[model samples]
Target chain A: MESWEILLQQVINGVSLGAMYALLALGFTMVYGIIELINFAHFNIFMVGSFIAMWVMQLMGFTGQSHVLYGLPLTAMLVFVLCVTMVATGVLGALIERFGLRALRGVSGTAPMITTIGLSYILFNVILLGAGADTKNYSNPMPNIRWEFGDAVLHLRELILWGVSLVLMLALHYFVRRTKMGKAMQATAQDQEAARMVGVDVDRVVIITFFIGSALAGAAGVIFGLYYNYTNFGIGYTAGLRAFTAAVLGGIGNIPGAMLGGVLIGLIESLGGQYLAVRWTDVIIFSILVLVLVFRPTGLLGRASPTKS
Target chain B: MPISDAPQTQSQRRPPLLEFNDVNTYYGELHVLKGVNYRVGDGEIVCLLGGNASGKSTTMKTILGIVRPKSGVVTYAGKPIDRLPTAERVRRGIAPVPEARRLFPRMTVLENLEMGAFTRTDTDEIEADKERVFGLFPRVKERLTQLAGTLSGGEQQMVAMGRALMARPKLLCMDEPSMGLSPAFVEQVFDIIQAINKQGTSIFMVEQNANMALSIADYGYVLQTGEVVLQGSAQSLRDNEMVQQAYLGEMKAQ
Candidate 1:
């Protein structure tokens, strides 16, 4: 690829990749913000989303041999798949919250954290057993539409992914700031005891937080399947770790900070991988994280005040 | 107002609203509440007065079940509630407005009030109680949509008190309502306390402002080094020589 074309492609790829990271990171950050639990099983939730979508698609009997849904355009089928995946994954997230996370409330910190890791392993193996160890392919009917602007080209899939992520992030911002339930969630995050004292159903708010955060991860998984065109039970770990880095890069608890941090990490990874060696990507990203922590322990944003217990 | 001179009745002989008998609490290995004993009668405004590190707050926490008593029992209305969780305590009509006005910073004043009635099941009753809280603190009504954290210190205190009142508790516990307020705000807080006491909800409060707390409190206990040093009617405690020098400040020489 030419220099200008390469730069353009990297920019597009970086944004979509950043959006995926942001989606997953939003879950990690929100769960951490509310309960102070890292929720290691969250990554497996994303992995499950892909498998759920594939299973649903197969059940629908819309084989890849034909590019139409009930004689409708292939786009509609893809949209249906996306919507179904979002709902299914959202319900799965709620179940995890109700049964898994809720059971561990008020317990010792180490126990829950370790349990989540254990849950992650269990989920990974369950997916392997159900779907087999083979990598699954999801064919996107939306062809790779490339828009050539002078010497640069932009892929349509990248644009769609970035657009959806931005919209989701913006919606999340409004929900947290504008809605009554969102405020309750923030209160619960800040101080669970205080939130309860005010009559906020801290438990309900926490469950809602898990639902929303997990749904976001699930959405990212759908988009990842569309963009990458491949899925496996183990993909969540790599993506989840990267998203975690994004969360830490932005202030962990602050919402907008997560977006900024995610995009920054994306840019570094893509640009660094292109200019420097691909092997140096992790080293560069983590080095930046260490430097940020040493200089500003609170990430880019200032430290959060300790809420009343 | 003149003191009621009516003869004692059978109802008056009933157990107090709240009773703490030799209650002890620990933080890790550090014993905070060392066998603290106290009681508050129905319709009484009782103050737990102490200096810093005297375990006044810990005693309040023990009553609310935020900190489990290592030994002894904390009973509310003759029921052992020492083992109950904080939410269950609130459901049992035991509400606490903690020190430092722990308002949900991101939530609107209205939402905070809604949270106050979390355990309440009746929508109409919850709404009525909210209106009552707004009536008590009209300023909160005006800032119904404003975030709790953005409110002024005195305003936050009002929200905290109103939030507690939403629970409609039989015994309302407050931990140092005047910790960070100005003198005028301090007086305002005490006035609200007295008003709340008059409205039939028993008040059990811990305060650093011993003189002001005793002034409004019907009964008072002086805590020193995690133990109750003295207990009596507010006026008698106010007049006690040790209390006068230690907490109430020395009287002017004639």
Candidate 2:
């Protein structure tokens, strides 16, 4: 294969990975934007989503990719698993907000943020004890079919990952931009006092934001399992950071920016891993984050702190 | 002429749409409102005037329950509202045009206006209210698709007022409607406030623009430190020696 072909292959690989990161990043940006909480646990929510999807697939009697699902049956099973995983994770995220953070709403900024750190640790340990610390295999339903174009090959799972993420992101964008509830969410995010004065039930909006964000993270987890075919307890720690980086890169709190940042981060990871080792990906990502913070703290799409605030 | 300088007599004269009874509020350990007692009568444009940190804004906040008072009762309509949340107060028909016209900068003007009527579920009336808001501020209609933050200061104020009106407010509370505006816009805003008052919406506003506020308001309250120093009809307050020396004494715009 030519050098550019190899780059293209890396690009495809990066986008598929980035799609998952973007979803997680969106959750981070949105939750941060509204409440000013870093929600460290959101990362593990994605991790939990992956674990749930795998367990559900196993429960449904699908074990391995050797006798992989095909056509309608495959599509049906995937849809069922995806919906279940999204709801379960979404509810879990909402519950964390309701029981964990709701009581601490006005108790200074640091309190809730520290609680999120505690929650992240709780989730990490729960999965570690329940599912073990070892990297487990994901039961991928789709057959790993490769499509070649001019010496470059793309996997079917990659397309599904990209397609599903794009559709969900678009749906989320529409829900926020066009719907009345979406406008209320934006109002609450922009000015909580103003939103309340206008009679918006801001608590409900926060709950909804958590649900949507966590649901997207759940979808990303399913796709991550489908694409990488591996899972572990500690994945959220790294992947969540990557998504957070993507959110910042795209301009934290910016919806479209999160998508762009996610893809860009993915590309950088894939390309960097291709040239340098995979171990260097974190160093490069964090270095870029540092540079972005120093030079343009608002980020590529972040116009100013005003918009985020 | 309609009411007396004493707050006790004023409440008996007209059924108070909103009342504060010895309301004391604090932030952290610092006491803000000492003992604020005031009444906004039905269909009255009442203004609270004070210098910076005089607890004028806190009074508005307490009425809206943005900040709960450490002690005392706030009654709206006929019920005790000190315990109600801001959203609940808003549901009971209290709306605020907050300090600095805090429009959702990222949302479009239309979206911001839509948020104003968030409490209302009647779609037909919401559409009608949107039309009413458009009628009140034609410029807001022209910039429906424009991001609210990008609007001019005067236009943003208009949108803010329009947003407040969308709530179909029985009591419209404004905090510093003239805070950041050109002289021309301040007059325009005051005129619109009076016009809204003529439409039968009771207004309770906190302002530093003493002269403009007195001109349109039916009643006025002056706060110094954290207590109501004077309370009466706009005419009497404007005529009082203390109010003139303190608030209207200087013929200057804030």
Candidate 3:
């Protein structure tokens, strides 16, 4: 490929990678918006989501290629894995909120946040013990096909990645803007006490927020596994940190901000890796984080905190 | 003023819309409300007047179930609500214009009103209620899309009251509605309160301004620290020498 063509291909690749981070960051920001918890365990949930998808694939007798199950194609099996893992991770997120953080509701800020770090360890251990602390190979059922735009090639996985992320983001936007429960969520996120006075089921909103955020994170995990063709217990720590950074960069608690932050981080990482060195990627990204925090503390797109009436 | 001297006796014909029987609430051993008892009859404007740290707001919270009393009972429409959650209490027709308005700052005025009707399933009725709120506060209607936080103090108060009325509650609780408003705005807020009371919603207001509160109230209770010190017809309370000296400031200091 020519230099410009290679840059274009890398840009596409960066966007695809950013879509995954945006998915995870959306969960981080949404949960933070409602409950103000950073939810360190969310990253581990994503890690577990990938492992679950891999095990589900194994159960479906998926090898390196396509297969038919009960007259259903391998694509159908992949869809099944996606649905099951999303639900499983969503339930896991709800369970964490219920048992892990519910009782600690009005406790000091550091208490619940510290509890999440501990919970992250617990989830990491569960995956490590079950999956044997080793990297597991993921099967990509999608046929190897690429569309060439001149000398730049677009992979099927990239299409799936961006398509799923955009669809989910739009669905979330619709849910939060057009629906009743979504309105209630906005009310609760702003003021829990005020929301209760207005007859919003705030406890229900909290649970729903956790479930939706975690489910999105889980979906990101599945995409990560499929796109990269590998899964491990430790992936959560690194990926979770990156996604968390994305959330903060876009403005923690801002939905569209997380998406923008994710894509920006992805592009920065990809372009930085291509131009600078792979080892310098983290340095570049963290530098952006520090600079953003120093200059625009609220974030690139986030407004200053509105004064409560 | 069409003040009722015996609202309790009249309400005895039907159960009081809300009743607090020997309620005691605490904030982690702070002992906020000590054996407090109060009631609001149907369509009555009952005011709870007290100075700062008098457990007046806590009384409102206790009724709303935001702060569960350590002992005693809170019943709404003859059903015990002490064990109910705050949202359930709201669904049971208890809505509060909490201290400082507490409007969802980022949400528009219309969205804030919509939140008030969140527990209701009747869309037609909610639509009617929105129209009713607009009728009550034309200023709020004029700024339906404006963020609640951007409104002036008086306008924010209007939105707050409008938001509560959207719940279509049997009883409306107002905590320090006049806390930060100018004298003119305070009078306007009280007028709106009385107007709302005349519309068949009972008003249970906690206020530091005993004069403004008692002037419109049919009945009044004076809370000192964590206990009810006196209860009477609003006329009697306003006339009493002790009330004038302590709260109304009708007499010059000796």
Candidate 4:
């Protein structure tokens, strides 16, 4: 491929990948924002979503067959499968808040973070034991369609991913800025006691935050599985770590910052891997994170005040 | 002015709205409130006057249940509340407008007021209380939708007081409401304090402005080194030689 063509392809690839990371980072950022704890189990929840989607599709007998419903063309029945998975994952996130995080409230910061890390490992192992170590294939295969614009090409799956992620981000922004619950979330994020003082059910708001963040991650997992057509038990740890890094880069606890950081990180990884060696991607990305932290500990947008402080 | 017209109950017979008996508090191992005792009767404005680190704020915190008193009893309405959490205390009609006017900076003035009644379940009652607060402080109404952080210091103090009133507390505890206000605003705040008391909310206030506090207080306690050294009715405390010299300025003989 020509340099310009390759660079354009890299940009497209970066954005598609970045959108997935953004979804993951949003979950990490939201949970961390209200509680000031790193929810290590979030990534595992994402993996669970992917598995759930796979199981749902298998049960529905959705094997890449197109169908017509209400005069509309449906590519695959797996859309419903993905939706169910997202909701299930959302509920799981809420359960974690109710059971795991709630008990650790007012405890030392290190204790909760360690607990989450432990839970993440436990979840990873449980999935490994149940689902086995082999990579699972989804029932809905990625459609191999490419639109050519001059010498450049756009994959259909990439276009769909970008479009859906952008819409999700916009909806999130609107929710946070406009809706009552969203405003309560912002208030809670800013000052939990103050929010509680205002008659906001602080506990309810925290749980809702977990659900929304997790749903986004779950949706991303389904999209990722559909795009790549494969999933494994151990995918969450690395992806979760990267998403967390993205969150820090954009400023942890800041909503828009998470998206921005995610996209920037994706660009760096894709472009760096293309220009240099693919294996050097993590090193380059981490080095940039180090530089950004040294210069601005707050991240690109700046850190919101942590709840306790 | 209405103080004289109200039926005079046996001058010494009314039960105290709040009573603290030999309360002791600590942060880690450092004892803050050392056997502190105080009481405020219904409709009375009691001032806890002390210089820096005399445990004025800590006293207020203990009453508000922010600082857990290790020993002794704090009773409100004849029920012990030393063990209740701060939120529960606020629910039970004890509200504190903390020092420095800890307003929610990002929230609008109206939102901050609403937060004061967080424990209230009746929407209509809360709305009515908000209107009452607005009526009490017109400035707050004027800046209802403005972010509290953008308000002037005096305005922030008004919002803080208004927020506490929204709770409809029986015993309103104010910690240094005049700490960082202008001299004019300080006078206004003190006057508001009197008006609030007249409205039937007994007040337990901590103040560094001893002279002004004593002038307005029905009863006053002078604290030094976390202990009350002198206490009496306001008029009597105002007449004592040491109080006159140290706090009240030279007495004018009739």
Best by DockQ: 3
TM-score per candidate, in order? Answer: 0.81, 0.94, 0.95, 0.82
**Clashes per candidate (backbone, < 3 Å):** 5, 0, 0, 1
lDDT tens digits, residue span B101-218, model 3: 9999999888888888888999999999999888888888999999888889889899999999989998999999998899898998899898888888999999888888998998
Worst 10 residues of 4 chain A by lDDT: A65-74
Q: Kindly report the docking quality category of candidate 4.
A: acceptable
Give residue A186's lDDT in candidate 2 (0 to 100): 78
Error of 4 at A267 (Å): 3.2
Q: DockQ rank, highest first?
A: 3, 2, 1, 4
Candidate 1 per-residue lDDT, tens place, A1-309, comes to 688878876777787788888888888888888888888888888888877776777777743534323325555675677678877777877787788778888897598888888888888999999888988876555555688866667777777778778888898999987776887788788787776665566778887888888888888898888778778989999888888888888878777777888888888888889889899999998888788778875788633443342
DockQ of 1: 0.29
RMSD to the hidden true structure, all candidates: 5.0, 2.5, 3.0, 5.2
lDDT of 1 by residue, B1-254 (tens): 11222234324433688888898889999988889878888888889988899998788778776689889998888889888777788888988898887887766788778778777778899889988888889899999988777788899999999989988888899999998888898888898888888889999999877788888987788888887877777887887878887776732321
State the C-alpha lDDT per candidate: 0.80, 0.88, 0.87, 0.81
Pick the winner on TM-score between candidates 2 and 4.
Answer: 2
Q: Write the per-residue lDDT of candidate 3 for residues A1-309, one digit (tens) a residue.
A: 788987998899899889999999999999888988899999999999998888888887775546423324745666788889999999999999999999998797599999999999999998888779778878767766789987999987688778888988999999999999999888888888898888888889999999999999899999999889889999998788888889989998898899999998888888889889989988888888788789887787784346575
Model 2 segments more than 4 A misplaced? A107-109, A304-309, B1-13, B252-254
TM-score of chain A of 1: 0.91
